[model samples]
Target: MKIKLEKILNLDDGEYRFHFETAARDIGLGLTDYEGHEVFDRPVVTDVVLNKTSHIYYVKLYAASDARFLCDRCLEDARHTITGEFQVAYTDLKSNREVYDSESEVRLIEIHKANEITLDKDVCDTLMLEIPTKVLCKEDCKGLCVQCGANLNEALCEHAVMQMNANN
Candidate 1:
């Protein structure tokens, strides 16, 4: 979604809110999407809070969606609800200064001569950061047996259990 800040730039200092949506293509999720999940293809809801604070634009982004992934332990289908929040600062006014104020502490984006900004990259990066390093179907998921290659959770293997007890 592209948001035009031209009108907001002309207005007096204030805050504004805008709601936008994006498809997989817009967020660079067309191929090898976020964690290789097809669910990212669905439209993602994005909320932007634009606040004008002391001539600086503070942008707060919120995105939420459900993603599917393969469980690492049991090799089963797993679903996780992902919610990401990000903050950025931008100034529409021209500035020749090389350094920005340290108080804001957000990545500064130059949008002085631009009428709109596309949030596709931001959304993609936010969601990508949410991808878990390890995926699991459950906290106590019992994985498959090494000896017989059987699902330990579904059926207990007598030999496997005996071997574990003996080793302990």
Candidate 2:
């Protein structure tokens, strides 16, 4: 979502509030290609504070999302919740034209006469950070049987034990 900051940028001390909802699938997070695999179904509330002297824009966002992931253990569909609080500093491109370091965390956006700003990419990034590297339905999931590919969560297969004993 883009917000016009004409008034906020002009003010010496300004507070701007934005509320909107954006689709997780539409954004280019590259989380999943399957439709409805991951959905961000939460309201995004952003508070922007501008410091005209320093030409800095401070933004804070509170966002949440729900995603469907295949559990690595059981291979069953699991639902995961993603929530994040993000704070970022943005400088006006016209006046504060400084090169950013390769490892700099701060994101810079070029501001022209157009006072529009996009929060989509920032929101998506925050959500992506919340995703866990490994997903499991339960902490102690038994996983699938290596021999027959049977879901161990439901029941253990005797063939798997024989296979393990033979290998050992």
Candidate 3:
């Protein structure tokens, strides 16, 4: 979303809150999981807290969405609430001093000429990063039987029983 900085720029140093709700696709989040299953079709809710301290602006972003996907372990349909939170700092320093520090996350913006700030990419990146590498319905998921391709969490397959007996 593009946040207008007109009012914010004119106001004195203070904290401001902004809320936004939009479709996941609008922010370029129309994506699929690792298994090619569609996810996060629901609306994305974002809350921003912008702290204007002098020429520096600190923005805290919180976003959330409901998603449905097949469990990576058991391949069963499951639901998850995907959420992400991050902070970014923007400075309007007029000095020509260069910052060569690679560890600094501060961004420079033209406070006099810029009209608005677009956060679509930031929101997309935050949510994508928050997604679990291994999506699971539960922590201790039994997964599927290798031999019979059966859901081990539901019941033991014949091959699993035979394997267990052999091991014993």
Instruction: Return the top candidate by TM-score.
Output: 3
Candidate achieving the largest lDDT: 3
Evaluate candidate 1 by giving its C-alpha RMSD to the native, one decimal. Answer: 3.6
Please give, for residues 19-77, the per-residue lDDT of candidate 1 as tens digits: 98777567785544345658464677889998876667778899876777777876777
CA lDDT of each prediction against the hidden true structure? 0.73, 0.66, 0.82
Which lDDT tens digits does candidate 2 get at residues 118-149? Answer: 77787788877888888888889889987788
- Per-residue lDDT of 69 in model 2: 80
Cα RMSD of all models vs. native, in order, equals 3.6, 4.6, 3.2
Model 3: per-residue lDDT, tens digit, 101-133? 244566777767787877888888899998876
* TM-scores vs. true structure, each candidate: 0.76, 0.68, 0.78
lDDT of 3: 0.82
- Residue ranges of candidate 1 with Cα displaced over 4 Å: 30-41, 96-113, 157-168
Cα-based lDDT at residue 51, candidate 2: 39
**Candidate no. 3 TM-score:** 0.78
- Superposed Cα RMSD, model 2: 4.6
Clashes of each: 0, 0, 0
Ranking by TM-score: 3, 1, 2
